[model samples]
Target: MRRSAEPDPSGEQAPHWWQRAVFYQVYVRSFADSDGDGVGDLEGIRSRLGYLELLGVDALWLTPFFRSPMADHGYDVADPRAVDPLFGDLAAFDRLVTDAHAHGIKVTIDVVPNHTSDQHAWFQEALAAAPGSRERARYLFRDGDQPPNNWVSVFGGPAWTRVPDGQWYLHLFTPQQPDLNWDNSEVRADLVETLRFWLDRGVDGFRIDVAHGMAKPAGLPDMPEYLRSVTGAQAHGVDDPRFDNDEVHEVHRLIRKVADEYPDTMAVGEIWVQTDTQFAKYVRQDELHLGFNFALVDADFDADAVRRAIDLSLEAVSRSAAPPTWTLSNHDVVRHVTRYGGSELGARRARAMALVQLALPGVVYLYNGEELGLPNVELPDWALQDPLWERSGHTDRGRDGARVPLPWEGTEPPFAFSEGTNTWLPIPPEWAGLTVERQLEDPDSMLSLYRQALELRKTHAGFSGTDIEWYGAPPGCFAYRRKGGGLICALNTSGAPVPLPPGEILLSSGPIPTTDLPPETAVWLI
Candidate 1:
């Protein structure tokens, strides 16, 4: 693919690197551990820059490592500017950025603007102050007898938590993550300063957490009955007071203003709005540069479902002329390998889907450990750490399974992730054949396929386009050709093999000894 360039400050064309860049999401605590404390840290990530550069990703998004109480891992941040001692100090973060940039890689960190750790000074002060005091005004605190309106937490239970003073505060996720009042000028200004602090320190950009949140509707009305359940709310849309509020756009516009000051820096939102029009609002010209359209992530492995997701995502981003982004897995969801089918069959589908995702235009985000074909590990009840486990009374199991530490090397439990024979979450003994050391020696390995696909996506003229043209295919299969670049990507999700398109095969998820695309296989052709 040709490099994407945009106009710079002096009217000179410069590489708008992020437009077609591949971003790898690094869940910090599970990536690597240099201190052998059973937790991954900055120095460990800095030590792995060569691996990332060789893997061929243009940038990496690190999950929150800011100072926190670890209530929701690092999401419950106590200090937005300070790095937690658990992940190393701010100086360690600087070293990681410097070394990463030296290796020609960009660094983007997570910004949790919708809420702050309950232990954060602001939240703590809000707790200490009177009901309507200035300190309490920065957060949503309601003094009522019936606990405001009925709204449930995304995790579980009521969204409002009562203070000892008989007033209630809003917490969309956990009580530990208090929702911030964006209506307060102080809250907006503080977020701006946080953005500048990291940009000045040489970071590339940010992944805004809960980008559709931070604003609440007037009256805090009760959510409609049909959207009361967690699954129902996610399926229907974000029409509740808890999320996707109209005022959220103003917050994103504020963020875009700060990002514009730094050239080539972009802000991608984790928007969960349902409709194409609603999702487009977050990426408007004056808002975020990109929004994470999770259609592909949420879609089933069926060919028709996959095609629909791609089509909807393209249409949504086209409204604002914003670049579209795609992903198969992230820290918060089940790994795609397991989500597909959870065994050898799942691995095959995942490999095929990787080509499908990388073949599309625009930016792509690859989750850490995804290249190794990592599947979600079924952990014992005693080993689960996600707050949802406790918050849901152990019924939901939470996301801890997907967040297991990466298996870098070795044959046993820790898999060389930590010098100690332990990890924050156990690495199953079955991953012996999937370690990076083992896979690097095998050309047919998942890691090798990813490395090759990413390199091809970067240099192949066949991948240079912003739009795709649909090609008719057999039932249970789909094909699309890149406009302006005659690259063809085809996939077979049917029960049997299908005829291959007439073209020079560039790459395939599985070997094609015959002139046919086998079930659960995808190929890139030119």
Candidate 2:
């Protein structure tokens, strides 16, 4: 069982640290570089610990850095227990965790339990073993030349690949990654051991990749309808059949049991189910500590869309002990700046949405470069490396645009991302004006807005409650007050100004008009 670090000193009940903590997702390759090796490494993360601390985030969710063939950029784990050499060895990871904790930032590493790299020892052994061997049973191996079912890979193409021995293996993602057979006891025990390996290393938690995908549906039936193998695939809901299988909950239950052994450790799942009830199931008392609902992330910048997204998000977790995790952007999707439509209007809406996200009742996840108001770049076809690029037959540009390395300073390519123009993904030269260095010098920049909001959200008495009450507002606008708390947040989605309600202005995403809230802006009040 988990041990409580802090006893209830005042006898007044409150939530866990993660319930109110602001988490910053650091896509390792794009974040920073200390080794001048073009790719960001664990050493790079340690060097930037102070920056994350000053940014006021309580936790840093580092994307996968495990040993891999880079087929999926660390998500295809060749060695789950070892750190990839590109990101340094286990020692470097340990130093990063220690330095981050010293700076009061918790570290949550990405854990991909759903599949293993085709090159993983287990998979390789399975490939060499006979069809009926125990090694073959550890993964989804089928005897026929045809795939077990018609399920397609998330990246694109057929989901199964035939081995030289004429057997098939399932991979919901790329062919480089083969799905593990969770019904196989060896696979289940291996995952538990992998969890223990990291927990014993002192990492605080895990951001489970494809957490809802660990279990394949019984009998492996083909989907009635085709769905894209991406974030939007979950829109098919309960009967989607490809993911969110009912048995996935048992996987989480086992994981939660393992997590409980380490006090204060958390497991946040990427549960992409559609309905509010479906979304809530992953975070029930015996499952995940938090389930990411992409309702707000996929919503448009319109008033009604934003309102409905929030309603569904809240309703999704209203019945669970776990809080909803909110994020406007992540590594997989297009950055919100470009998604909202680029330039001025896009920037305004992005900032406004940030205010809404930060003022919400639960956990908030900020993707790197978002505070810099970075727009997605239009990369050349040759520059695209997402597996989706190849799998989609070059029809899709893939996620290289949002995965560009962040610019810390300077005015050119690499932008201090590394010593030369050899960054893993090119950093846009135009980002010169949006570097963290430039933004810090300009107090009114997006970086300042986020910094101030995060600090206030952490320190102020106004942001004390979890409940929200809707306030009457004009069309194309929203106003909500925190129940039992002094804070109120209002956003004007209209093109024209809207009247402000009674309260002292605590913070605004942008400058406010003399007597009303300006268009495409959000304000916090008390």
Candidate 3:
């Protein structure tokens, strides 16, 4: 059957498929378990398509589901061509692509090109080959008594691990996940082949993981002094020549080539860069479709800070020839409901933040459970599965807290995730009361507010328009105007009531205090 073409609403064809899209990020292990084996699978995600459609997302960004040993979750791919048995096989994946498209929602899978699990056949072959052999050169292998460079792993240890055969392999993450040598033409070719394998399956696009780390400095020099403080002997910043090396562009070019071969296929990069200008480089005409903006994710919630991020993002996209994308929370970070605050006031602040995200001029990513106002689960160190926990001596407490299983049913035994006896991550007790079933029935629940916001976004041109004008607000307040076609929108993020300049209030959070905003309240004016 011929594939259906993507709809281009505006006359100027959309620069990238993801721009203007509302993406729901699914942490596969915790989404749903079809086999009742205590783990979420592709079929499980298929069952939730209706729920996603109801929430009004255009696409879904699923975390890695490839064959893996699970050391660093699915990021440590042992085989890029096949799905892990634990998650489901290739046939199941094809079914998911078919099901999601039928619902008008695109599907993008996570692709970890920076590294591979030690168990991967490529790595295993390199390990067995003689030093300096063609196969061994595909990976960074050094025969010296020490590592080739002073780079450190982000997981808090030396980035190079010595093989028993007197050679060292580089790893930007855990020792089990060795970094790939992008300088090798064979490695790049294989990666392209792997990508094409999926694209041919009707998958819409890919979310490239740790994309900036694909290249290492050619010189492989010792760690620089400026990076010492931040590195603490760990991985350097993405811009570090040894990290986001210029050679990384070649990787993108290859990905772009593959994406262009198929109609409507897109590629988004998870680039950890400081400035939007630097981030812009990742989305040029020949690079990725969207380079996610981490500025807001790391920004302090304040009028000035928020305004700066938005302005910077706009300026960056203007410089780039491609569209932009934005996200708040993901599986790797603290939940927004907890990061902002855990009280009723905190929930209100989170709502305001959501308004800004949805109103931004690019694609927006929504992490799972955000609609239910879920907070990070406070799990004990013993239950943590993230390698960060083991490497940091439990001080960092890894990402397990934010990755708890979803609460579909309110009951304790299954937690609505599965009828199985074991779940990948235990559901937090507090989340049971905030289950999907319970929230769906409560009109004042966060779920309902999210549904309404999305509904408004679809109907209100101001919500999805790219044209924006920043409006100055009093201390501790944020205001912005979005105008498109004939629609206008004004938003106030302030604690005290601020007089509206005469417009209808389309939506509001919390009560307005004395004609001003109460703490953690936001209002949309038309």
Candidate 4:
């Protein structure tokens, strides 16, 4: 296959580098450990830049490293300008950015604009006695005995929690992560200031958390009771007034304004909506540069589901004239390998999924350790740290199973994280054999396949472009073709033998055994 034309990067005609780039998502608490502490820090990430570069990622997305109480694993921000001491200070973060850029890798940090820690000074002052105080207006407060309305929290409980002195405040996650009042102009301006602070510091961009939830319905109405179940619950509902509130556009516009001030700076949003149309709205030219498509994350591994999702996503992006972005897994969800394919066939399926995602037209996001084909580790109730585990009564293990620290060294003593006295989450027993060191030396390992796949993507013309055609196929068989740049790419997502029309094979999950697959086999043909 011919190589794709080099990306245009000359003058005003240059395309954004992120448009054709691959991004690596780093969950800080689980990525690497620098100090003897059990937690992964900026220095730990700094030490792994070369490993990422070797694995073929263009940039890195670090989940929030800001000063927080760790209520939601750093999503509850207390200070946006400073880094949390547990993850190292501002100086350490600056060093990470500097070293990352030196290694040709751009860095984007998670920015939680929708809320702040209850311990934040702004929230503290809001709770204090004051009439029409600026700090009080920073967050929503209800005067009556009841809440401002009856909206439920996304984390399975009442959205409103009462503060001391008898006033109700909104909290979308835990009471610790108090929702900020976007209705307040002061709050919006403050958020813009926070964006500017990070941008001016040499940070590349941001991954806007809960970008859609930043704005709430004016009169928070009662969400349906059926949506409140702890397990098997539809965390988000169409009937819920919180669905794509119009006020959210204003927040995006403000964020866009901030991005415009910096050259080549990008902002990607975590908009967890049902439809592709709703997701597209967040990526308008004047809004966020990219918004994650959650359809793939929630989709079953069947062919029809994957085809429909790709079709809908393509249509949405084409309609909005915006670039698309795909995320298979993140800190909030089950690991892709475990969720899509069972433990027995998980690794094989994961490789095929990577080719599919990488071949799609847009920015590709890779979660840490995904290249190693890491499976979910079962943690006992006593060792789990996610609040969701406790909140949901252990019905769901929350995300701890997937958020364990990355195994860089052999799974022994510090598990390659830190030589510290205690690790935050216990390293799983199997991690010893799946360490990065072991994978690097093995020729047929998932890590090696990932490197080759990314190199192929960077050099293949068939992998680039926005035009795509979803081909009809059998059950459990997903196929798609991208036609442009003088190349045609097709993929099969089934365990059965798929007859390839007259094209050469570009990539396949594993050796073809008897022209039949066990399960979760993927093939790419040109």
Best by lDDT: 1
lDDT of 3 by residue, 131-187 (tens): 898878887877788788776667666778998888888887899998888888888
Cα error, candidate 2, residue 409 (Å): 0.9
Tens-digit lDDT track for model 4 on 155-247? 656778886677788887888988888888888888888988888778778998887787888677777777666332236766667557978
Better of 1 and 3 by TM-score: 1
Better-scoring candidate (lDDT), 2 or 4: 2
lDDT of each: 0.91, 0.87, 0.79, 0.79
Q: Candidate 3, which ten residues in sequence have the lowest lDDT sum?
A: 228-237
lDDT of 2 at 267: 91
Error of 4 at 56 (Å): 0.5
All candidates' TM-scores?
0.97, 0.97, 0.94, 0.94
> What is the clash count of model 2?
0
Model 4 lowest lDDT segment of ten: 1-10
Candidate 3's displacement at residue 518, Å, is 2.1
**What ordering of candidates by TM-score runs from best to worst?**
2, 1, 3, 4
Cα RMSD, each candidate: 2.8, 1.6, 2.4, 3.9
Whole-model lDDT for model 3 versus the true structure? Answer: 0.79
Per model, state how many residue pairs clash. 1, 0, 7, 2
